[model samples]
Target chain A: MIFGLVFWLLVIYFVARGFSSRRRRGYRWLQRELPSWEQKNIINAEQGDAILSLYKLKRIEPRRKMDMVKVLTLIGAIFVGVGVIFFVASNWQRIPAPIKTILIMSVTIFTLYMGYLFSYQKEGFVYLGKSLLLLASLFWGGTIALIGQIYNIPTSQNWFIMLLWAFPIVPIAIFFDNAYVHILASALFLIWNFLYTVNNSVANYYYPIIIFLFMLPTARKLLISRRINIIGLLVASLYCCFYKYEWLSLLVSVGLLIYYLIQREEFVYLYASSLSFIFWTITFFTVRKIHPNFYFFIPIEIILYLTYKDKIRENLIMCLVGLLVWLNLSIYSFCLAFGYKFNVINFIVMQSLAGMVIYIIGIISKNREYVFSEIYKVFGYLVTFVCTYLLSFQAMIELRAQVGLNNVYLAVCSFLIGIMALLVTNEARKGYFENKAVRLELFALASALLVNLILLASPSVLTCTLAANAVLVIFAIINIFLGVELKMSSIFTAGTVIFALFIITRYIDVGWKLKEKSLFFIVGGLIISSLGIFLEKQRRKVIERMKQNE
Target chain B: MNKKIIFFFIAVLWVIVVAAMIISKQSILRKGKAVLLETLPVDPRDLLRGDYVILRYKISTLDLDQVKSEKPYYKTGEVIYVRLEPRDKFWEATAVEVKRSADSGIYIRGKVGYCYRKELGVIYGIESYFVPEGEGREIERNIRREKSSVNVEAVVDSKGNALIKKVYIDKNS
Candidate 1:
């Protein structure tokens, strides 16, 4: 406890000190260097103008019309081929390290030269050259490092340290005006970090920073380029979110957002900035371990409130961003709640509650989109519930320690849970006349009943209740399909309730099997088959009815 | 005002972010310092919460003659300097070093030391410890856990070369 206390104090002190006005030594150095850099930029601007004039003169001179397709193909082939070679080399032990190094270096030099030559041309060939260079670097560097690990020279740590240095070649390529190299570098850097993250090593943090820096030059160029800045920014934003460096990443994004705001000189920044602030405020509280649950509503509420304001289109963007953040937070919460084996109940309850709250908030706030947003969560909960029900009886029998003395009660409860799931599904569907959600619920309801019915009719079944449940389950499944074809969410929901009866029937049956029930099996099977055929006919009728209306 | 200026600012911001990202990547330090208000005397016990001596930092450089006869100054508060090192291959500090001292002081129980940086002058501490004390071991456990903060006291000198005087436990922030 003393150790924990002391540790936090040190953190508070250093962080506080860092935020203080005492200007970090590095910051002081940066301040001193900025003036000189400013002067250099002025020089470069003048020089660049002269170069542009020369470039115009050169443009009038004879020049080759580059065959971009051939160049791009060659570059693509090199990259893909490198992947194959690396894949092979990773598995093979006999390849000499020096030979592999030479092979990689040869391709590296060629690709770099090609990239430099194409830098000022159309950007298509530039991407190819850059990608090839990055791939070559990975293969050469990774192979040598792996071989060193095998030989145990300079230690594994040294090899890792070396790779860290080698990995920056992608960004260097980008810095030199080859965006393709940047892309290649970013992808490799992302993959490398992902591998380490899966290994749960602390060193994985470097991956995000690498990709962030790697893509900066490219992203900067995009702000001026007429083509697809949004897509580029979105990708970078995703990378930032993925790597858990959203703070600074978001700050850099805001700078871009500010530029966009100024260009349009619109109030969109108000919406964007508001959404950013509210989302982060909630994130901030949650991260600090203070009143996490209360703050979760802040973003949703602000978004809904903003909808009633003027500039509906800007508000819509804010609403969408807010909704996305809420969902993101919910997913994180769900993982935290249900990620552990012991938290199964907590997971289900929390997700259900979260979904229901989102619905309630949407209704109260009069934000239709917020209500519509919860379809996936509702479907997720119901599908998972029904699947669990399908396996419940067997699960109980297999994991006896969990079932205990309340086996019959547990079985009945599983059935009830399935029924409760239908209630959630109905509420979800009723909230949105969304065809997608209704159809999905139909799939879940039908699949669950079908599985239950199979468990009953199979000859080697252990219990009579299982067999009886199976019959009811089959009927329920047919009914659901019919409802789905009719596009009636309510009717489909009712079918799910009927499946719940299979659970209830199991509870009332005192004996494990209904005595002398062999005849019932044959009759039940025949009836089920006939009912399925009838439902198929009904499905055809519904489709025909819909077509006639159209 | 113009596209060029906008582009230039963007470049500058990117570079700034890159630099910040690099420096921020410096892993947080897990060790903290605290002062012992009173001297604590302890016995060696194998099962005293996993074999560590509970340390109270006495005056850093004790006048062995002054406190030699009285209560062994066991309960008198001493300043303890906690040494933490960067995690190497074995998750142990490969090159162990003192972080920062709270202050420089002369006394058996209040003196602290072991301050060194790769490129900085050492700062001495007000208190130091004779350990197998439980506190030192707890500090070890903390550094391993990568705890967000550790407690260190500010020992200000006349020259204002303030170092972390000692490592101490504080219940409240």
Candidate 2:
């Protein structure tokens, strides 16, 4: 199963590469280089021939400037790969001293040969140099992994001590960008450290955070964007939040937000703002749980509201709502567990009150869009809560009457609620939902109804069965809507969320179920994959046909 | 200035060589001085703290007339070294050499680094037996498992010249 996953990932990567190449005029430019088509081949084969010709071109063409840079890169890659293989084979504890000597001597000799090639006779010196550097990086990284494995039962103190020496190497790799040495080194360091951190009380594991921080300046300068840096920072922030560095996470998010806002880098802006929202949301939940009377969540909510007030435009509303829904669900779950019962009246009343307050504030500020929009959302939530309460009551009464409910009925009820919530959300989104905040509120209402229906229906059927069904249906619907609306990030985020959900929920289960229904599921998955490929093929065909006609 | 750039590269390379040497000096120096004992197995847990391979003499396998300490047992501070000879294919201490009456007895420098036992018979921290650079990794793995042990057989001449002859794992049950 694991190997299969790796294989499929490779396939996906290759296919993506192929498509990107085509988009970059790879076929058009390279096809002429190929020999003339044989008469035995076909009467008409344009699209397939283009792809094949492009592949042939990439394989055969001398990329002439395999110069100093390219040679160095290849050398580096080879070094890293060989280093890992040798380190694994040596198995430090099992080899005789003579053998160890011979192995090290051999590696040293290889390194020298590569070095000589780079310095003197190599045609593509840059490529050779890169390969050497890559090889070195891999060895450097593989050594760390080997060391960690060797001292598998190292003390926490010893692990930290080793980390002090090891963690700094990754940043150095980045500083040079000579190779991915830093990345490999840091990855090796992180793997063991990650294992140790789990079920341990070592507070504020700083290596990952430091690594992300170190990558930021280089990522900005060399990569031409803050995307990778932001992702790293976000992950670090999550780790910090998870491990109880709440205040630090908040401060870091704010600092990033201000830094990005000043620079006007969109990626940094989104990352910092979203992360800050998360930190505050988490803070609100945790604080409310710890001290119910503190009412700190209220102020945090206000801060979030103000911070995102202008930024959370119509398109970002659903995203914002999604965040809120998640936060509230966590809060609700925690609060209810601690003897805090939530009646429908109190919950609806609180939501309405919050919505009304926002609405009134918007009115007073003369943000007419906010006033009209937020009022509509406040009403939407009010109606949703009422309907949810009635339906749940009806479900209870039906259960009492029938003494049983089938999976089909559960599916029906869930689908109906989902559709209804979606329709109402769409209607509210038209004009009255001028404010992103209000649209977010309406989306939250719909999300809440959908979530409740899902939860209520799930238990009656098999455990993950309902979740899988609802997720696919909702995911498809949302994807189509988002695509039609041309909300790029939202569509991508939804797709990513769907992929993550499927991987997490069904990956292992599917793997196990594969053996039993091996033929069916495998065939189905393959068919779906092929269909996607076929669509791409068809699109290419249509484009080619259009060009010929033109 | 051109000379200086050349000098700088040379200096960096020199520094790297020096660092590598400093890290690996002890193991290199101890190479070929002693033979690994193939008859006895070394514990896997004891291979980590630098290139010294520590082994227990497998005294249970030997039928000895008596086991004796070379120095005073109750002494507070004593330096003792034992000279061992091959007896019936087993290495046994033939003579106990004591430096003073003031110290502990029976100090061995093989497995742990320079181990010295107090009057209470508790031996702590010995550093003995060095293996060359690459072999350290193998010894480390051997110490982790109890199936077989890599041991070195040393040839000693009549004049007490100890030279390593061969290395083998004595897994004879």
Candidate 3:
């Protein structure tokens, strides 16, 4: 029964992959290139024919780049897996118990086969394959569940069951040499730790050490990037915070950053310690809202010293962004839990300053041509636009009565952001930046500094709202002009979409009653869709213009 | 060749695991003593493993006075044994203790859930019973109508481990 189940599952999986995507990749590559090569006399017609024959006879092709087929396959896998899980969960009486168990086993085998095919198959989609392996891990858990269902074994939310699911995949991740699979294994192991501890404090500091051992092998393998390894270290450091050793989690986080600054590639020192911190913080948040210990800033100070000494700009910037996100959530949760007043206006002001900090960092990263330069710049623009748009609401009159920024969290956040601006200025003085970008960076810094004062003074909601709407219009216009200058239509379209959303949001706010807001959303979605069409046309125009110039 | 060997090994390993799981569960059911427990069931649909009734037994919560523990409060996940005495066709908790009595004939083991000052909640492995989809709501409705109607027959091994064998709802309730 098990063998048959496994066989049918494999057949179903391959059939799904085969039917959805045509394996005409090589043919397409040949078609695109062969004619051009022939016209250029790069290859004779006879040679071309020979290559075509080779492709046809061997059923082999050049590897594909990113395409719709892989995406479709990924999406299809998710849908099918979820559908099967839901079906299994239903415990349908129509399907006999044995059949239900068999079906689950089949899916488990099928997903694992797909994962292996993707990750380890000769000429496999390694990136997609690792993701598939993670999905397979999930299916394996489902397989356990179905078995539990079949035999009336109690398995729901059993922490031991999660450990069972996690352990088997750890070897797979290491053997397959896939970072994403390692991440999945790490996350699952961490989740198990949380779930188990919630059951009882049976696990000790050794829990994090176990987690570090998982990473130790991956780090030694040296297949993944140094940056990912660093991130992994940071993630592992999450453990200490989880077990109420908040100071330890924070120290480990800084310690990892410092360790990476000093350590050589693929060599690790604090393997046991890294595991302790990440598991604690992530697991802590999973079980209960964690208060950021006062020790948070101590790490920032250490990071500043390291930044000054090492010029670790890329990791530092990414680390700052990660900390910003983590700290933002933790502080908000702290405020809510402690009954501190949460003012939306203050939040908006804080976000804008945060945006300025991100934008300035983006500018600096772009000047240096860092690996994730575009991403930082894009995120910077996104956060700035989102905050600005939020602030543009005309209904600020109702929000005028508010707690004046008594938020120590906001102050601490600003201080962290101010450090970023200072770093940018220090770099600019060293002549490490271009004039245009530096100017923009300085403007963002000044704006951020000016707002901190306004935020501190508790400006009236009406004045802030008017200023925000004007700034929004100005920023949108600037984005459109920048797009034209840079010959990038995505930004131009974004500018158009933002301006439209600004108008539409206010109309939605005033004209639409609470009941009719869904209509507003529908219309807003259509507008964005139309703007996308506009973007495609404008993008083509720019391309054509560049081609003509060439 | 190495990859092929690993694949075959993993495949065989899973088969063994599934087969082993079945054999172990079957062994417990075949050799264990069957005891009936009066219970109530609540329903929740598991995303991956269909709709099921969560059985909260009358014995799930024990008063501090009833249990003979060294301390007043028991920590979560601490193991405890409940000695059962058959009362009116269903076994009821007669005594609770931290140490299992080797001399006892009928008892069940459970882990301590978040124990409050006045009450200690325990979780036996046999808490959830998977029911057919769309049938769980009806079962829940029946349970609501007759609170004392639900009774489950469970199999207990020599080691004090228990598995829920069957659930019975009183027809005249």
Candidate 4:
């Protein structure tokens, strides 16, 4: 209970942090960019001054102080309410059932009354008041658990508990316009969806009911990114409904991708990258035997091609997206031609290959095109690192997988990678190689290809494993250097952690004398401590450099 | 939608639900007949509410050869009526009917679990007994003891609804 309470408190911290003014950020950005705009002759001096004055007149800075107040009060009230709950739980069995019921009811009612008094009757404590109101519902859930425990109520029907937990508090969350509370409600609703889907064979028109009744209306009323996350939960529900049909699920995802791409062209990379995960899962883990039909890919590929053909040459993102559709179709064709079933090593190699290609394309289009480069690069990093990290294991390298597969995506992606590499080489001829970022991107791409080639050749398990580990170590170093160059702490952390794990994994399985092992542990501990200190100093230097540049 | 009114409604609604659940269960305990039956216990833990014992009653499985089901086989989740009559100190299943016939007295409704191979498995919904944390294993061990027996005392309503009132572990010490 305390852990759950603490977890929610942290969530509330992040939620409360969002109260810091985005409008202020917009002004700050304008303030910073005005001089650059002036230098570029995009806006005249008078217009810039007018814009500055307009922001100044609106008076946004004072809200920062209010955000602090809101966070503190919300945190404090939640602590008190959850404290009451913990107190009740500790003494639950000691008290008689009737007294326990009274105690639970009284506490719940009192919190509601106090919350009402503070929110409606008192002023300047609305944050605390609403928090208490939210906790009032939370207390009711505890009451349910307690009473159910006392009465021996069956929870084998997890759907019942999910329903009771989810449905009650959503209206309160919506009414209060509390995004954190609304998010929690949405999470519970998704849990209900999973439990219900698992318990009942039929999905039975359920999510559409919630989606129509509560989800969309709340999204409209609140109109925030948090509300948008509820839509993501709808995807999970739909996934649950169509879990048995991976083919139908993939088609649904592809349809969603096309719809979103057409509707919001700017967010094409994000929608594509996120929805691409469904392809990865369906392609990798599917047991359902799919017979390849050449005609199946024709309409789908033609539709995608006709839709994106005009944009493909002009837009780098669309260029890759066009290839993505081709990749899928080619997988089907390859399945037909060679009768190649999917393997674990093949999937990893292919995903890594494609990821590097996407990343190289992102680097190529960095400033030349209007692109959301971070999202593209993030998808690349996620697939590449995760795949490469898995390939490091000896078991994965040696495991001969004979599974049901209807796709071989690697063959087509290699062709795309070759063309993209040619484009990079062409750019290099014009002295684009001088850019360190492009050099790093090329290095990563080469490393991915080398790893894929090594895995493709049937070598001894030790050779593949060692080579994979070596490549991972080199990439880790590259990541560290890139992090240092770009001043990104997360990438730096990932690099150091991966290297540490690499060292740990090497020492883990090898047969060593106990004394030698102890010696290594002590020596390694000292080295890690020194490295941490060095990295901290370097990180500080990077931060200072960034600030100086700013 | 005044804030205070909503708060009042929410608070009142919670209290009413709690009260209603308690009142209904209390009515069943008070008015319904108490039937004792031998059962086996299996201990399992729930994440939130802690440990519980699943009671499998002797009456849970019905032999089709003895008192046949009305239907050839019942599908999962299909409601089936199980008529109980006193046999020694415990109640035994007399017949399982798709619908409660006129002679189906002192019966409880169960959802069909598996009804095939001349055997029918019925789930009475009174199978779960939520114990205090770490205590279910003790009761389960007692139920497994050869010298003694574990029995479930249940209160069955007129409309065939049943709730386990208590799990009596009569382990001879």
Best by DockQ: 3
Q: Where does candidate 1 stray beyond 4 Å? A: A1-107, A118-167, A172-180, A195-207, A213-531, A539-550, B1-173
Model 3 stretches astray by more than 4 angstroms: A1-151, A157-318, A326-344, A361-378, A394-400, A407-452, A480-498, A509-550, B1-34, B42-53, B65-71, B101-106, B129-150, B165-170
- Interface RMSD, one decimal, each candidate: 18.6, 10.6, 2.6, 2.7
State the local distance difference test value for candidate 4: 0.64
Provide the DockQ value for model 3: 0.49
**Each prediction's DockQ against the real complex:** 0.02, 0.04, 0.49, 0.39
User: What TM-score does each model's chain B reach against the true chain B?
Assistant: 0.24, 0.38, 0.90, 0.92
> TM-score of chain A for each candidate?
0.43, 0.46, 0.50, 0.54
lDDT of 2 by residue, A1-550 (tens): 1232232234334433443455447544544444334234532356546666444333244346646656556655665666555555345557754454445434643553464356345564645554564464344334333332332212322344345334434433453354344444444455445544442434344543554456444454444224444554455455553555555556556656555555443333544555454554455444444432233344345435644553433213323332433434454554456545433322332332333333333333333443234333323333333333322332333332233333333433444455554544554555545755434434444444454544453444343244334434454345434433443443434444444444433444445456567775776677557655664564455445545655
lDDT by residue (tens digit), candidate 4, A26-64? 667777778778779998888877887664422223223
For candidate 3, state the interface root-mean-square deviation in angstroms to 1 decimal: 2.6
Any runs in candidate 4 off by more than 4 Å, and if so which? A1-114, A122-132, A142-151, A158-162, A165-171, A176-341, A363-550, B3-8, B15-34, B42-53, B59-85, B94-107, B112-122, B130-148, B169-171
Question: TM-score of every model?
Answer: 0.37, 0.43, 0.58, 0.62
lDDT of 4 at B166: 80
Which candidate comes out best when scored by TM-score? 4
- Tell me the lDDT of model 1 at A97: 39
Best by lDDT: 4
Model 1 agreement with the true structure over B1-173: per-residue lDDT tens digits? 34234334433443353344333322111222222233332323221012222333223223323322222222212233223222331111111112233444221112222222221111132222222324445554554455422343433322222233344443322
Winner by lDDT between candidate 3 and candidate 1: 3
